[model samples]
Structure formats: C-alpha cells, structure tokens
Target chain A: MNFDLVAQLAISGLVIGSLYALLGVSFGLVYQTSKIFHLAGAIPFAAAGYAAVWAAKSLQLSIWLSIFIGLAAAVIIGVLILVLGYFPLIKKKATLLSLFLISLGLSVAFPNLLQIVFGVDNLPLEVYDAEGNPAVPFANPTYASGFLTITKLNIVQVVSSWLLVIAVLYTIKKTALGRSITALRTNPAMASAVGINNKVVYLVVFSVSSFLMGVAGILITLQFVANPTMGLQWTLIGFIAVFFGGITSLGGSALGGLILGLLSSLSGIWLGSQYAPIVTFAILFLTLLIRPQGLFGKEAI
Target chain B: MKTTNLILNASNINGGYGKHQVLRDVNINVGAGEIVGICGHNGAGKTTLLKSIFGIQPLTSGEVVFKDKDVTGFNTSKVTALGMSFTPSDRPLFRDLTIVENLQLGAHIVKDRSLIADRIAEVMEIFPILAERRNLLAGRLSGGQQRQLSLGMALMVQPSVMLLDEPSLGISPAVVEKTFEIIKDLAARKGMSVLLVEQNVRAMVKITDRVYVLRNGEIVLEESGDDSRKRTDWWQLF
Candidate 1:
C-alpha cells in the first residue's frame, strides 16, 4: 500500500463514513427514545433521494428547494409511521419483537411500493454543459500531492456531519426536551407521572430521525445514482454501523460508521470490491457473537 | 359527623396482569387531607388497586372517581394531568439522570417553566438530601434516598392525590422511619391526600389515619389507625 493510495482510501472512507454516521445516528435516536427498531427508516432515505431528483427535474426546482421538499416528504412519512404503525402497536401493548417484525415488513413493503410508482430503473442526475455533454466541474481545486486528490464534496460531507453531530449532542445535553427524552428512556412510567406525554415525545424522535435519514439519502444520491432497490442496502449498512457503535450510544455510532467506512475502503483496496460486503458482515457477525451489546450498548433487560 | 370530601374513590374494581385478576372487586377511598394505609399480603391486590387508580393498570370492572370525576381507563399521563402522582413499589427512577433532572421530569406537565422551577425548589426543600445530591445520577443513590427521590418526583407535580406503594420495601429500618416521618409531615403540613400501600402493617399504621387490611384480593378488615394499632391480632392480617 503506497502512501498516495492509503490517503485516497482514507479520504473516501471518511466521506462514506459520515453518511453512515448520519444514518446510524437516526437509527440510534429512534431506538433509544422509543425502543422501536424502525426498519422502515431506510425507506425515507431512498424516497428522499428519488424525490430530490424528481423535484429538481419534474418540478423545475432548485437543488436546495428539492432537498427541502425531500426532507418534508421524509417527515410526512415518519409521522405516518408513528400514527399508523407505532401508535397502534404501543396502544395494544405489543411486544418489542412483534414491533420489530412489523417494522421489517414495512421496510419490504415501502420500497417495492416505490418501485411500482417510480419504476425499477436507476436514475442518475445529469449535469450538462452548453454542448449538451456530461460536465463535471471541480467546485474546489484539489491539491494533488502524488496520488491523493481532495474534493469539495468530501469536505462538505465531513464538515457538515461533524457540525450536525455537535448540534444534536448539544441539544440532547442542554435542552429541556432532551431531558424529558432521557427520563422517558430510563423510566417511562415515572416520566408520565412527571407529566411528559410519551406519544408526543416519540413523535418528535421519529420525525427528527427520519429527517436526518432523508438528508443522508440525498447525500448518497448525489454521490451515486438513485435506485428503488437502494433502501435495503442503505438500511443494512446503517444497522451495521449502529450495532458497531453500540446501539444505545450516539457517539459510539458515529465512530462506528467511520470505522466501518475505513474497513470497507481498505478491503476494497486490498482484497477487491467483491470481498467488501463479506468483510462487513463478518465483522458484524463477530461483534454480535462476542459483544451482543455492541461496543458501547447497555445490557438489555 | 362532618362529611369528609372524597378525593379518590375506587369502587368494586377488578384488575390484574392478563387474566390473573389480582384485585377482586376491591373498594377503597381517600378523603381530603387523609392518609389511607392499605396493608395486604403479597399478591393480595393492594398494589393492583393503587395502580388501577393511577391508570397504570386497567380495571376489568368498576369505576375510579377522582375529585368527583370518573377517570377510570384514563391513560397515565392524563391521570397525572388530573393532579395525581404515583410512585410504584419498585421505585422506578430515571437512573441515568441527575436528581434535579429527575425531579424536573416530575413537573413535566407544568407548562409555565418558572412555576415548574419553583415547584422543584419547593420539593428540594422538603427532601433536602435530594437537593444536596441534585447533580448525582439516580442510580447512585441509596435505596432509601431513591425512595425519597421517587416520592419527591410524585410530589413535584404538586398532586392533590399521591399514591405510594411500599415506600420502605428495601430500605433500612432507619430509612424506613425517616420515610414514614416524611409521609406524616407531608400529610400534616401540606394537607396532601395519600394512598399508602404497604406490607409492613405496624409501621404503616403509625402514620396512617385509616387502615384497610386486604387478603386474597379482598378487604378483610377496615379500622381506624388507633384501633388497628391497639389490636393484638393485627399480625394475623398479614
């Protein structure tokens, strides 16, 4: 492994890792607050990605407006899940395992539904020049020292992910709503006695998590092409990152995302692309077997 | 005799987890400024009765009237909003949160932030140990302190009716004495109505104004606190 090749791998890993971190954080957020593993969370990401492109092209909207529209769509989907899925289950006092299976079923149902509506064809957004040819612009000039090239998108992803993480951490640590969430997690009965509405809190958590996941999906779409079938893969990667970080620990998930990204990149470099998924799954299986609680997860009662 | 205002009334309530039916048509009441002690053997439906009143458990048949309103089947949050607070037998505290945070959560229904803060401060004064350990995580507290914290949390809502289940279940004798003292003080000083459920009949009788001894999911005996205390056969109820 040459220095240039290692640097390239490192840079790409960090970019992909930040995306994973965003997805993983969304997963952790809903899981910690509501104890619901929303497998359908991934649909928001794929939906948002496809919606962003459709908004820009069909609706003739700007990039930023399209992103906002995508986010709003995600929020609406999330609220629907809470109203239609979570509320009924909780009201019925359904077991956690039952809720988990329901979420899994929803995950499968949502993307296929998307496929029916959007078609199974993969759509890549095109950037065209005056000549109607594919145009790739270097937004920020990269300083190439040997073989390592740094791009503006990489910087945006890394810097934005860090800023978002910091903001979320601050909110959780300093805000009254955050305190209520913590209270709910620790003792829900006591939280209610204290006057916190569990349903409202769960709604807030699910919406926020979904919004972040939507943003992550948009980012991934920008990097790759949007496909109806991409949700499952994104969900799998997010779950792995979440478990790697420790299911309950947000900070742990962020670190886990970065580590998984680095591992994937290194595997792709050394062992070839075909070995990447195997390595990721191998790590996930071993982690579950050795530390079912994840690296920082609390023991479940 | 003056008719005492009834704050909470549970009439012929039957409730349980699944079909077990721990509470079999139990009738209980708490009057304004009254401390009612409910003593029963394990699985005798004391906790179930309290839980049904607090909306933690659903009643199969019967009605729970609070302050002249039928509140049976209301969710726990709605019940709390109607000025009732419950501390369960297990003393469920937000273990990861600081004592102050835990107390703040107790007053979550209070929309006016400043009023909530004032209530929290007032509660801290009553449980000074909680104030002293305000920054400590609830999990680190002693069993007695945890119980006090749980009680304090219930009180933070400034509930007109407070439900406490086994406040001294796992605490030391000294802590139990202190707990009973606090219960007595809250009743006398604040005129708070309490439904105290306990397995320790003797200690419970000392602070309670009235006692209901339950056995096999039914009220087997009912006596004034003074009469219950003087009776030599009180141990037979347990």
Candidate 2:
C-alpha cells in the first residue's frame, strides 16, 4: 500500500473534480431550465479558450484582460446561438428532439470551423515578447507540503469553481431572479401566467452557463494548452457529472463531479489512468440500472 | 350575446395541436366582475379556448380584445402583463415552492417589493389557511388547500381578468362548494372578471353569471347562469 501515491492521487482528483464541478453546473443550469441538450455549449467553451489565446497573442493584453475578453465572447456567442438558432425554430413549434439535433449539428460543425480558423495545432495561452518568443504571463507555480504537491493553477481551479458555484446556488435560493428561474423550471405555463418572459430567462441562463464554461476552458488552458477539440471532451465530462449527481439538483451535480474526479483518480492505483473513463461509464451504467434517479435526484431523468 | 363593460372577448378563435384542430370559430366574452363558465366534456376544446385567449396556446386565427385593445397573438407573458392571468388545471401551483414563494412569483412582473409583500398579505387574508401554512411547500398541501392556494396566487397580481381551467378538479364535494363560494366572493369583492372552464356543470353553473356549453370545438348553447341552473339536460349539450 503506497500511502504517498494514494495521497497524491487524491489531491490531483480534488483539483480535477473542481473543474468538473464548474462544468457540471454550467451544463446542468441550461439543461434543467429549458431541457435543451445544448451541445453547442462546446462552441463557447472552445471559443473562450481560443479567444483568450488570440487576445494574448494579437492584442498583447494582460492575462486578466484577455480572460475577461474570453468570457465576454463566450456570453455573446451563447446568446447568438439561442437568438439565431433556437428561437426561430421554437417559434415554428420545433420539438425538443429537433432542437437537440440542431445543437448536435452546431457542436460538430463548430470545432471544424475553429480548426479552419486556428489550424490543427494546440495553442499555448501565452503572451509574446519583443523577441517574438512565447512566454506565460501567469505561470503556474508549484507548492508542496509534506508528500503532497499542488500548483497555483490547481488552487485557483478549486477556489474559483466553488465560489462561482456558491454564488449561483445563492442566487437560485435567495434572489428574485432565482425565483423566476425556479418558476420557469417547476412550471413553465404558470411562469408565463405570472409574467415571466421565458425567452429572456433562457438568454440569461445561456449567458451564465456559457460564462461558467468559459472559466473552465481558461483554467484548463492555463494548466495545459488550448485545443479546438477540447471543449466537447470537457463538456462531455460535465454532463456525465450532471447525470451522476442528479440532473434535478445543481448541488448534487457539483458533488457528483467531485466524487467522480476522486474515483477516477483513485482508480489509477489499481487500473491505468486511461481506464478512468471506463470506471465512470460503469458507474453510470450501474446508476441507470439501480437508482436511475441519480444520487440526489428525487425524480427520474 | 350582450355584455356590459366587456373586459375580455375572443372572436373566431381557431387553434389546436399540429394537424389536429381543437377549437373552431369559438367566441366568448366576459363582463367586468362577471364569473363566466365554459362547461363541456373532455376533448371538447374547453381548455384550448382558455389557453388561446391567455396566449399560452397559439391560435391559428383569432382576435382577442382585452380592455378594448386587440391583443391578437400576444404571448402569455404579454397577456399577463396586460392584466389577464390564467391558472391551468394540472399543476396550478409550483409544487416545489413555499406558499409565500409561490405568491411572490404570482406578482413576478411587479418590480416593487413592497407591493408584492402587500399583495401576499392580501392573499393571506383571502386564504387564511395559506397564511397558516405560509412556509410549507405547495405540493404538501391538501387538494382543497392547493386549489385555495392556486386562487390565492392568482389574486396576488390583482388581475382584472382570470382564466381558470378547472376549479373543481381533484377536490371533494364539500371543498368544491366552498371553493366556488371563495371564487364568487373574490370576484364580487375585487371586481375581477373570471372565465373558468369546467366539466362539473352542476357545480360551475351555481356560481357563474353566464354559462356557455361547448361541443365539438363550438359553442352549442349560451344562456344566463340562472337559465342554465333551471335546465337539467347538460349531458345533451356536452
């Protein structure tokens, strides 16, 4: 029993789990409210990473400013997809299946579009100096305590993800906006009768959801490198967390992500890291077979 | 039919699910402070007519005049903002929300916090049981209490016209009578016009000022509530 190895895996799991939690909440918010599959969320996630890289390289902006620009781009792109893609179809009385198909088409096409624009190479999130050399502006620093080691980016991932999640949870529980969202989610017909603009709420949720995805994308890019195809994979993990936790409860989704991360990491002790997804799928299969409603979900998805 | 101070009028309302028309040239009107009833059996387009007027269900062709303005094709939120509120038959209240939370959302369009609070207080006065169980989830309430809370939520907005799909649904005979009394009292007291659809013709006719009998997506007969009560052959109309 390698106790040191177990401790290291646990720390790594927590960091990755926090990122998954952020993504889970993002995906869960849109899915729970409108029941949209929202695969086009990948567009914004990839775009945010690319946008941050572009702002850093082309605009020569500070890392913070570039990050903000990336987040803004995510929000704008998300709103446009709803306004241009979903709203018109909704007006024509499109079915949920039709909308999900549209999202599927967009999700597939968007990465190809990014490939054409940004090429197949992964882009490092770094600023260029006078010598035309790429340099990381906010380079992640390593911190070690006893047998455990962590990076600055890892700490940021955990702190920022939980903060945003808490803010969203609070907003949903205590604010009028949250009440309006709850009304829409719980009973859409009554929501409209009470003068809640469903489309407006959709726009807000899309913006917020995209913003969360943007943050996740940037954090991942900082830890590694931005790639055109990264969004779909990360987002897939997010929805998996959502289903694992409970689609009906956001907090459940977040907790589900954390547990998933820990399990995926801890499994490395017995199986290879590559088999983590296999474990995840097995858990999902068992959940479907047994619980079906998820750990925190009161209703079946 | 002659109506005094007409608050809501739907003319030639035609609507339905895709390729399955439910409402056909249906026209109805309710006067200010009037309690109008639409009675029919299941699948007679009673709910369709109410939804069309309230703008939840889209009308293929119709002209809805509310407070003297042609509000054709207005969505539910717009219609609600124009002082019309609709409560559906199934899941009328947000079951997950507390009674107070549901009432607050009843006035979602109102930006004034104090006004919303005042409206909630007024609703509490009207439905005292709601005040007693103010913090309880709406889903936890008894069938009769849920109906009362639904009406109480509608009253939160102080709507000029309220469209209720079925008020007598899922409640006992004793509660049904009491619910009707509360509805009648609310309309008489607040001068709010109510257009409720019900299959419970006997119970509905008692509290209504006028009743329309719908069959096959069209109004088969229209009569004063008094005349409706005198007649015992409602099954023939349905």
Candidate 3:
C-alpha cells in the first residue's frame, strides 16, 4: 500500500517487461511463420548468455566482441536446429506434435550438455584481467527520477526492445522478406505457389528469431548471471507473453510481455516473488477463458 | 495447334497424395496465347493436374517440359523462375496483406525493382478494382475483387504459363464471365498460356480454346472449345 513502493515496482516491471517483449518477439516470430512450437528455442536463448559469458571469461574478450559472438552463436545454433533437426522431420512430413516432441527433447538435452561443459555454477558476465582474475568490464550507471531508480542498462533494455520490435514490425510491413514472411504466415500454400521458397524463408525466420533471443539472453545475463537452467523459464514466460498478447500479431505478443512484466512486478506488493509465475499463468488462463484471441489478436490463430 | 508450338506439355504424369493416386498418366498441353480449360466434377483431379504441372504437387512419375526445358520434379520456386505461375483455388492471395503487398509477393523472385514496379502497374491496369483497393487488405475485398487480385498477383510474374485452379470457385456468375474474358484477353495480349481448372463447365467452355475433361485421374476427353460448346451430352464426360 506504499505509493513509493508501487511506483518503484512499476518501473522495475517495465524494465523486465521490455526483456519479456524481446523474448516474445523471438518466440512469436518462429511460431507464427512456421507453426513450430520451438520449445528448443530455449537452447539458443541460453546459449547466447553462456557463450557471451564464456567469451568474456575464457578469451578475455571485450564486452562488445563477446556480445557479438554470443549473438552469432545463437544464430548458428538456431539455424542448425532447423537444418539438422526440424528440416529433416519436415522433409519426412512430420506432424506438428512430432516436431514439438523433437524440440522438447533438444530443449531438455542442451541445458544438461551446457552443465557438463560449464560446470554447475552460475557464470556472471565478466572479463578476465591480465592476471586471469574476473572483473566487471563495463560500468552500468544508475539514473534516478523521483522515487524511482533505473540503470543505463535498463534504459538500453527498454529502448533496444522497442526498437527491435518496431524494426521487425516495419520489416514485416515494408520489406520484400517481410512480405514473404507475412505471405508464409498468412497463406503458406499461396506463398509456395508464388515461388516463395519455404526453406529460405524458414532460415531467415530462425536467424532473426535466434538473434532476438540472443539479445534477450545477453541483456538478462548482464543484469544477473548466466546459468544452464535459466533458458526454459524465460522462454516459457515469453511463450506465455505471446499467448497472452495473442499469437496472431507480433506486436500483440510484445505488448503482452510488457503487461505480463507489469502484472508480475505489481503482484510482489501483496504476494511473494515466488507467486509471480502463478500470477502470470493465472492471467494466461483468464485470457484464454475470456478472450482466446488475445487482447490485440484479430482472431484465434 | 501444332505440337511444336506447345508452350507447356505434361506427359505421362502419375501422382497422388501419400499412397492414394490422384493423377494417372494425365497428359495435357497448352499452346502459346491459348486458354485451355480442365473441367470435371469434384475430386476428379482437376486441381491435382494444375498443381502437378506447376510443381506444387509432386508427380509420382512424369515429365513437365516448359519452354523446351525439362522441369520435371522441380519445386514450385524453380518452376516459377522458369516463367510458370500457379494460383490455388482457395484463398490465393495473402489475405492479411494489402493488394500492393500481395502483388509485390507475386513477383518475389524478381530481383529488378523497376521490373516489379512495372508489373504492379500493369496488373493494376488489368484489374482496376485492385488499383482502387491497392491499400486495402486483400481479405477485405469482395469475392469478385479477391478473384481479380488473385489473378493480378499471378500476372505479376508475367509468366509464360499460368496454372489457375478454379477461377470461378467463389465468384458470382457475372464475375465468372468477366474473369473468363480477362483470362482470354491476357492470353491473347501477352501471348501467355493459361491452363485453368474449373467445375463451372459452362463458364470455362466459353473462354477456352481447348477443353480437357478429367474423370477420377485420367483425361476422359479432349476437344476443341468449339466442339465442346456444341455438345449437349456433358453428363457422360464425367
């Protein structure tokens, strides 16, 4: 009931919400176009954070270089999942359930693989100094207004999230590739009939989606630390956001994530942080019951 | 027409979905500047034939020679690159996209921007209703207008061979006549070859230079459009 506490919570929610929005876009992009559940999208999401952390610690790389490598790693792994995993199944005319099962298997397997490689310890984003001692490379400055405090990184998270979402929406609206994606999503049979290569479009979708997931992972890693178990939780939250926002519209999914973030943050005022996910799922359930199409979605996808 | 002037020839085509055969040695051809019609009852492989020729449906065993090239077993994109376009019967246009966006997607393979612009302009000219609704979502258009936009999208490729499945599927009878006229005009003017499948036998027969009646998976009859119109025993063809 403290107003100052409420305002601070709201601000914190927006920051986390922005991250959720980015994740939603990442998950929604692949799901909307390919109708692949892509449960294994978690692999790329976690991979980005782990890769960035590894690059900084092991290679003594700069923050920017590590982030770039992280994004690149995410992209490569994401595309490989499609090429080596889904594409073969697709060629064999695998059902959506079958594809989801494969994705689920990979999702379960990759994190364990990461644990074996990185050990069962959380790795913070830090660069090793000349003496091989780890140190935070960048100064994430804080900016405060009124009763609320925010960081430069928080601002970056919010701005980059919106910018990337807008850029993706614009691409879907104006670019040739965007048109093809829209075509594939809306009318796939017509898309193929008009010479839109399914494989090429799927490749592009996976790359872009993976890139967004990497950014989300990197941003979260900067704030907290990278752990093998972190991917699926955030990814499930993103999936919830997409469903909450509506699966049909990407912008809707972004908005959904923001709302989810706000609600989860505000719920901390009355309930413990442990109940945030319960609140999130409750919203999803209510949304499904009240409006299955989602707040921004035109129809049920 | 002479076989030498054939622009599209699908000979010995045998194909189906899974193990169920939908096409059985279905041989069909289209001459340049000709509008050919394939009319039959539902489930008569009318759509499968067009899909087969355009490589949307995989042929079990066949050869599709387009423009003197053996395009057999080619995917839709490769076939489209070879100046062939297919427009499916149901929801041909990307319904969520604007008329202009759909046209742009129609020319998705074309790298030349100017050529795409020109094609869009030409398609708009051909279907003025689409021009008026250029900014509107294709799904918002009327059935007749949707048909026009679908045809315009197909024409965006400026294809040598266009395989249209059920042009008269959902449109009014009046629109069906207009659609046929437009098809005839396009074929005549652009020297484009059209092979359209339709269940609207009367409407299809009116515009076609040649008609092939498909029953089950085989061509039951092939006749000149003039002879097809003169016949009264259409029931026996199926």
After superposition, candidate 2 runs with Cα above 4 Å error: A130-132
Cα lDDT tens digits, model 2, B1-238, are 7988999989998999998999999989999999999988899999889988988788899899999999998877777778888888988999999999999888887789999998899889888899999999999999999999989888877899989999889999999999899899999999899999998888898999999988989998899988999998888777
**1 against 3, candidate with superior lDDT:** 3
Question: Model 3: how many Å of interface RMSD?
Answer: 0.7
Q: If you score just chain A, what TM-score does every candidate get? A: 0.93, 0.97, 0.97
TM-score to native of every candidate shown = 0.92, 0.96, 0.96
- Give the top-scoring candidate (DockQ): 3
Root-mean-square deviation (CA) per prediction: 2.8, 1.7, 1.7
lDDT of 3 at A112: 94
Q: Write the per-residue lDDT of candidate 1 for residues A191-290, one digit (tens) a residue.
A: 7656677888998888888888888887777667788878778877988988987887888887888888888887776787678789889889888888
Please provide the root mean square deviation of candidate 2 (C-alpha atoms, Å). Answer: 1.7
DockQ, ranked from best to worst: 3, 2, 1
Q: What is the number of backbone collisions in each predicted candidate, taken in the order shown? A: 0, 0, 0
- What are the clashing pairs of model 3? none
TM-score of chain A of 3: 0.97
Question: After aligning candidate 3 to the native by TM-score, how far in Å is the CA of A29 from where it should be?
Answer: 0.7
